[model samples]
Target: MSATEVKLFGKWTYEDVMLSDLSLVDYIAVNKAAQSFLPHTQGRYQMRRFRKALCPIVERLCCSIMMHGRNNGKKLMAVRIVKHAFEIIHLLTDKNPIQVFVDAVKNGGPREDSTRVGSAGVVRRQAVDVSPLRRVNQAIYLICTGARNSAFRNIKSISECLADEIMNAAKESSNSDLAAQLAVSAATFQRMIAQDAWKFLKYMWVNSVASDIPPLTHPWAWGLPVTASLTFSQGYAIKKKACFAAKVSFLHRINEHVLEEFYKDYRVDDAAMHVGESAARVILLH
Candidate 1:
């Protein structure tokens, strides 16, 4: 089916859509066509063309998406299509698809240099209708699509980088709503990055692939749930508990030094010996 026909499933075009917005057929077609064969230039041309077709749609549809409106579940349909388009371009052009898509989004969004006469001899510049929401949509789409099947470390690092950039932008931006949207995406990516990082560390800990966890210095790290009793059924739970017990013992031995110092100073075994006699001209300090 044609790209034009796919709009029938989307609320962005919102005219009598009988199907859900997140349609799979169009992307399936794009993937099939892309994986088949196309010259580099031809693939690039189609990528650009597909971008043009999808731009206005994203521009209009992203408003709802930014507001957290799902548009009757069609919100992701456009994103999926763009991802497939990128996949096609990668197959045909040997370029990293996310990079290409991100570059296009940065350079291709809006231009406001056009002018026209308005009802008289005076000229006025036409407004660029591509909003911040549109740009955010494009960036989020790229990030989410790139997250699939990729190495967790790679995705986590990229997400952290994007989140930092977005947070910086939010600080400098004047539009409150736009800044809030940027902040939301930044927070989302941060949570994902943190979770992914925890997963990475947890895998290392459980498999004994690395012994750096709980650190050689800090026994406190083992107090967390990774080595907790609930995780006992896990493969490394027994090891974790043993290591924690050892660290606790080590710490207790270290504390003995403190008790030895106190004993030497007081020369008495009383634990809470008062240092001062009852009120022989004692000075009171605030």
Candidate 2:
């Protein structure tokens, strides 16, 4: 039989269901390449990288439904739930359920994500663009996750919950959007709090270093070793080069008067050791 002739569950027809989203047309993957009655590939695309994108989108939904909690490893159960959900979707919308599902996926996917930039002390969150494949995956994940959460400890069956979730998502009113937004907000809040706490600790560290410096010693003697140690411990190649440049700048800033005072008591070696000990102590505590 031709692919278009095949019916899902020998019932719902996969015809005239168009993907309207141009951006996800390549990644959404709604073709009849893997059309089947059961939607099981037995992990056929697992051997090759990124081959899962070739799997039918409906099969992908079924697979997504099989993840987490009691649903884990239960393919047939997932298939049944998805089939019933599609039936409900068709009943409610009086449209192609597959088209509704595609719309849901396109609408539910997140477009941007918060990411960290710059060095440890100067780090900041910036909104980054998400890949098309990741957007589709995240949309499916959120849809299934919301459905599962809604059905938990409730009278509603998972199929009904899934159907409702998809419908709401298609209309841009799903709890999946709220969940994704809250997740991103919580993560950003936590990171900001952590960064503020680190800044306070860094301020205290600078004060402690200044107070611990010997009276006749140059301030750079104590600060340089500790900074270098920290930089080397946590920095990348470019950061290391920047750290070396900073060391050179500090050396140039040291005048003949400061050098004379610095060499008077031979305290530079002791100061370097103290910095090493302090860095080691902080590392151990961390």
Indicate which candidate wins on lDDT. Answer: 2
Candidate with the greatest TM-score versus the true structure:
2
Give the clashing residue pairs of candidate 1, or none: 21-74
Question: Can you write out model 1's per-residue Cα lDDT over 1-286, one digit (the tens) per residue?
Answer: 3454433123112222221223222321222123211211122223553443333322322222232244344545534444344445456546444333334334322211122437777754332323443443554443333322132456444233333332233233332123233333333322322233224323434544234335533434544344344454662544444443433233223345544653464342331122111110111110
* TM-score to true structure, per model: 0.20, 0.60
Candidate 1: Cα lDDT at 100: 39
What's the alpha carbon RMSD for model 1? Answer: 25.5
**Tens-digit lDDT track of model 2 for 75-183:** 9889889999999998999977888998999888766566778997998566466788888899899999999889989999999999999999998883544756543
Clashes of each: 1, 0
- How does residue 7 of candidate 2 score in lDDT? 70
Show the lowest summed lDDT stretch of 10 residues, model 1: 277-286
